[model samples]
Target: MTQQPHLFCFGLGYTALALARVLKQQGWRVTGTCRSTSNTEEARALGLEIVIFDPDHPVEGLAQRLAGVTHLLSSVPPGAAGDPVLQAHGATLAEAAPRLKWIGYLSTTGVYGDRQGGWVDEQSPLTPSGERGQRRLDAETAWLALPQPAHLFRLAGIYGPGRSVLDTIRAGKARRVLKPGQVFSRIHRDDIVQILLASFAHPNPGAAYNACDDDAADPAEVTAYACKLLNVAPPPEVPFAEAALSPMARSFYDDNKRVRNDRIKRELGVTLKYPDYRAGLTALLATESATSSSTTA
Candidate 1:
């Protein structure tokens, strides 16, 4: 029998958990890092060798834990302006490159900035508008410059089982915010895992891929669709100027670019399981409804 490659994920967030679970099922000896002891135990119970590491405190056993790890994936978001991982662990990764076969860094498509509702592909120039977006772009550059084979995956807004438009509607927080021609792209957690697995199987070094769905729908349309599905009234439409926005939400609204996913499909030979939000949100709502019914029955 063929042996599966050993894998280590630096952050076991929502999307990372899906990727780790899929790899574990494929016979890979998967290990991951978390911030707390509870998360470490939870990850171990799910069959991942867990390591507790917080870049803020800088643990001592990182190098030892990563020993003999063939594949390494990082989903850690960038810190304030100067990220410690890039300043400190950047050299550490370079030193471990000879033994590490593949590395992946999760980034955000916000790096492209607002395209005025225009389309952007892999070849488009990156001009991040916000501080967070700029930091992520910088981190991507740092990872790509490493001596080892590294790939950057710029992900769109991610939604999954417990996180979707239906949940927002049920929580009475779904809003139809109209930003003129503003449209946003998103990818499901399952599809993110699929793309990552495909990249691992094929092993492309020093490459960048956009992980997004096929559809780029307006935010208003998405909320309306969710309300229709749930047989509820959609929230009142709010004008972009009058909408109450948090710092993060305002920053997100700054970029209205539609990211293209052709490179991941053509190069990675990947097919998205939830190609669009409609299919993804529909399935999530169905599952939620079933669970609700079962609990009440």
Candidate 2:
């Protein structure tokens, strides 16, 4: 029998859960942290060793629990109150660096602000336009500066399973909002997991990778495509300037950059499970429709 590495994950969110699932299947002893009691129970139910760690209510023995961990993965968002793992446990992790083989930090491609529909790669400069993007950029720097082999994964918009363009359309949010020549990159959650696993298999210290698909489609085209897939009329078109937007929504429009995933392919030797949104959304819709039909039958 092969000896699996012990994996410790911080911020067990959607993407983190996907990674955990894959790691567990590969025979790793997967453990994760949760801020709330309910989340702790949920993690336990998924066969993960759960630890409660909230900056607000600091728990004892956190360092001890993390002592023997070999691989560490963090999906915590970056902000004043967001990244508790980095703010509170950076030193603990640094101290345990000898045993730690690989550290993965989930970041956003937003770090490369609007390239005016141009392409950006891992070599691109970090110039985030929005506050959230800036925060992510800062966190990436903090993690890399630590005394460990850190791998930064700048993820594009993530969608999979319960989350996809078709889901948004079914939920009455398939609006065709155009920002002139605006384009955005995306990746399926499954593909993100595959890339992360590949990176783990071939560890690269201080390496940065963009986790996006091959296509950088226009946002309007994606929404319209989802409507067509669902056999529903596409939502009326709304120009960017004419649309009423929240601060967060408007910030998304600020970065029309296309992220390149060639580094992950070349370095990690990863082939994307869903190279484009078309295949991803179609698979998700088929599963959803099948589930609905079974429920009614």
Which candidate tops TM-score?
Answer: 2
Q: Write the per-residue lDDT of candidate 2 for residues 1-297, one digit (tens) a residue.
A: 655688888888888888888777777899887888776665676799877766775546768877667899888787665566778877787888757889989999999988998989988889998788888888888889888857999999999987887877879866777788898899999999999889888998899999999999998898888888888999999989988788788789888878888998888999887899898888888888899999999
- How big is the RMSD of model 2? 1.8
Can you tell me which runs of candidate 1 are displaced by over 4 Å? 1-4, 290-297
- Cα lDDT tens digits, model 1, 217-290, are 99899888889898899899999898898877877788888889999899899988889889988888888889
Clashes of each: 0, 0
Per-residue error (Å), model 2, residue 66: 1.6
lDDT (Cα, 0-100) at 240 in candidate 1: 88
